[model samples]
Target: MTDDADSGADASATDGSGADADGDRLDVGFVPAEVPGAGLTGAVETSALLVEHLSRRHDLTVYVASQHAADDVDLPAEDRVEYVIHDDLPKLPHPITAKHRALREETDALESHDLVHSYSSVFVPVLADLSTPTISTLNSYVAVCPKGDMRYHGKRTCSGPGPAKCVACVGVTGARRRQGLENEARSAYSSLGKLPLVRDSMARRNGVDAYHALSPHLAEDYAALDFPAERTRVIPHFYDGGFRRDPRTTAGDPVTLLYVGGLREFKGVQVLVRGLAELRSRGVDARLRVAGAGPYGDRIKRLVGELGLADAVAWHGYVDHDDLPDLYAGADAFVYPGLIDEPFGRVLLEALAAGTPVVASDVGSTDYIVGDAGERFESGDERALADAVERLVADYEERAGAIPDQLARFEPETVLAQFDELYRDVATGRLRRESRPSSASSPTPSR
Candidate 1:
């Protein structure tokens, strides 16, 4: 892939032909918030995978924002994709203004593609003005919730954004700490999202031609927030064909539970630790392997000591991406105990791919991903989580049997074919936004 922004100027100058000399390949512009790389969030990893898969059959140009003009990133050497780094914009006094200017540059660069598929929520408002057909993947809650995690006051799932409700939520909720000017500037931008003009601008669905939701539950949540239901398609993230392991036949003497994600408050890692204690109280010998790091690490570690679980919990802080497969395979079951409605749990997919049964909270699309391969407890319920883990252990073999069928739904070919069809429909202008009758009532909270 070429990293020069000007190298493809001739190719991008013409209106997308929808089919090149190959007759099947289309010019696709992939817009991700940041350059796709390892050790980043699941969303970026998903974009990287999509780019790899799509480049096999289409002409792909990835547009992203970076601090430097070029990055020394490692992608598959064989893939035919171009990286257009929009780092030429001058920095403004305010970080928010700088970000907006960068978005404009990226959006302008994407205008010549046959179809633009965006993985960035921040690009939604800017992409709305572009005439080219566009699809924005609903990977996060930034478009709907200013706090960006869809949690009301940083504790529970928010209903939907309202001018008054959001303003109060951002003002009163100690969700983010003001540590520096950058953090304060972000807080201010989130605060601005509560205002009527900005909130409405972000919420408008007139510009995006279609929405690709990772799960059915996520599509519903965005629909309630006024995203056009007809324009939304539920396409899940495919497993990257790594982490495949034979299903375990028997549970260990002491069950090993794995949790792989950021150790943030909204992640509900505290609840997982507390649940481990509850399980021990019920005479269940289980050990937790936490394989990620975040600001919540110290607090969760302190809670572990408070609960007298110093020996049972193993902290594998920030496990490398290549090393995660072994950790997933070693565990009997993986647990995701998030407090808020997760947009989609990519970690759950990784666990299932490793032939590990999942024990996740019934928030967001956990049930959709886990299917019959695991058990789910109510979100943030430690006792219930304990119960679910115990139940999975009792019937581990039966649940393990269902892994193949559940994993088949997200096989790369199946998912890539869906995207291929969506791309054709969009590029041909067959997929157009439909008008939805506006409702005055506020949206109900999503579970």
Candidate 2:
């Protein structure tokens, strides 16, 4: 793929010839290995906005390729939301990357869509196979590196991800090395002059029309990957139900703090645990709640026990998305201390949308997502984290004052408008070459 920022990284898309000839009746479908749920909401939510909008506004039919059984999700379905399932992929124990079922479903589908909106990087090849116009989102580094997190042996710097390095890192970390092998294979396959079917993921990423970035910080990552700066766009994630539905209520006597994501080393859950332990020892009346399961669950549990914080920390493992709203309502503050550079950090958006103030690591896309709405401290500094927590928990007025108004930031209406403008401009052949800090909203969100 091209690397020049002037052309390759800056998307210069005009409404395609197909769109000009026949776009009103185009079948705009969203193809993902799985419909956005579980722990990944950033890419899923953004794709849903496009899917939901195309279904509601344009005369388009949205088909969902679900890897699961014939069962349909209970989430609200529009007349446009259709489902297509496959029999090839098994729906048992191993379920991290739904790419296998995605390939099968796309290859065997009886129908064709006018345009394909892909959430998973693996499905880009399938779109190419079907001769469908596709825009793929680079959700993670699974497309480019061995470890899906792009984090090297618990360190932030993305290291040499070759076989020797990957295997050695996996051996030391004690995490599963087999999946890393598969990822290495996938990355190697893509690097060889880009496959026609699978190459669209990189092709569109380098210069696609109306693209989405979770935050300005994340946009920088995409820019580094050679995504056209003009094509790159920022859209903060929002909950399924628009932000206005949930009424915010204050917490009870015990100040509640929550962490809700993968419990691995990169998530920095251990840092939050250590900080909370220190808070207790320092005479703070606070409680820690964790609601996610991962390979590091046992390790986090062991660490909590070792730190003597078992009683103060409650482990409500693997809370589904449906139950998250109530969890947010019950909590006073949300914390996500990710050790790696988070692409979008949907947890921060969800917490703020629920009116639960948050404290996040000042790394990756946290600052952009926070937008001065909450507190951010250095990534691994437990004392700084503790200090931020205490500041938020100290007085009622202080917490209220500290939480910058986040309602507008996470509102779907607000983000969708920005998307509509970008898409219209792309479709109608308008180009704004300026990349960062656009005049639109100042384009600055903290760090």
Candidate 3:
């Protein structure tokens, strides 16, 4: 891990204008350890965007704790933004409890910062024990739900986290006998560890000063997790202007249905393949193009073959982040068939910004984020997904026109203002510090 002085110096050098020298400049530290996926995860991108927007005036430092090599992720280096790669930390076992294994050494690294923002729920307890005020961003459901996606054994979405429900769900879904047992044991352990009293005790020990949710649905989840509703704010994720583009006018025949994201069961790529097959069975000319890769690649491909969609499906294999906007712009519509309760679909926002209409499953924050600009169907309902795809393809002109209104809410400036207010409130004591009450600090973990 890089020392604070080195990081501070690097940030100071980047801010050539010396804006960070101001007396009121806030020193903000960001921890993104529990970020999921491999290359350019949503949490990583959000951290980059936050630095880009917040560094103009604040002294910014990002502590990236990940299982993957630090070089794989990139961050903005302008306006006093320094990204510290904490690559020494090992990957946590279960996605949910990963947050609970926060290293004391890492926590001590943030002792000098004025305020720290942790995007990992596992570190909420550790952050609570620090002198620095802290805020946590609920980017996903792992903090509360052990399955992370809130999908019950890969079958369908569930109401919320529960030990019995999670155990039964994992027992049915887990592939191998030993794997199922492990999942059940881990699920029960994580669920019980997150009890109200346990979570409250963690929070009282300098836990989180505030909670930031990407959607109202997530804010509701936070409230259920015992976080103070008044201290929790629903701040949507911001979109980088790099995704903006002109809407495609020359729509193509065998209308291309695009799917961009991890090719996982919960991601529902198989559902998209099934939906496209249904469209073909009805004699409707349609094709599907998937631009991301995952462990489910072979399984998804096998399903496509089983459905006789070999000629209708195109695999683009993990499209680069910069190239996604163009891909969205070229497609007739972006289909997000995710079967789980997605905390927030950043890709849906990217589709809208790129002037492409979205067709997603009616789960999680899709309804809240997409609003009328996109189409939604029941989760895992292939027939309904096919219908939405056919409808959007037919009315491309009308659906594409809603892009502007849909993209307005995620405008970078507007979202940045909300974040700035929260930061200033915390920095200047306008917001209550009760969320991060003082406690006896913990010592750094030995290397």
Weakest 10 consecutive residues of candidate 3 by summed lDDT: 1-10
* Per-residue error (Å), model 2, residue 265: 1.9
Rate residue 16 of model 2 by lDDT. 35
Relative to the unseen true structure, what is the C-alpha lDDT of residue 375 in candidate 1, on a scale of 0 to 100? 98
lDDT of 1 by residue, 13-45 (tens): 244522333366789888775667644778877
Q: Tell me each candidate's TM-score.
A: 0.85, 0.73, 0.82
Write down the TM-score for model 2.
0.73
Model 3, residue 352: what's the lDDT?
83
lDDT (tens digit, per residue) of candidate 2 on 1-447? 111211211122223322223343344556543553312445555555456544443334444444444344432245656655442344332232244444444442313553455565555334333333344555665544445565666465663245556555545444432325555354344332222322344543432344555567766665666667676667665544532224334555577899988766678888999999878878887799999887667778988999988788998987766688778757888987877886777777777766677788888877767655567788988888998887666543544443445555655445545644544554343632222121233212211
For residue 50, what is the lDDT in candidate 1?
A: 76
Better of 1 and 3 by TM-score: 1
Task: Report the C-alpha displacement of residue 317, candidate 2, in angstroms.
Answer: 2.1
Regions of candidate 2 where Cα sits further than 4 Å from its true position? 1-26, 36-54, 63-66, 70-72, 75-78, 87-114, 125-133, 159-210, 242-252, 395-404, 425-447
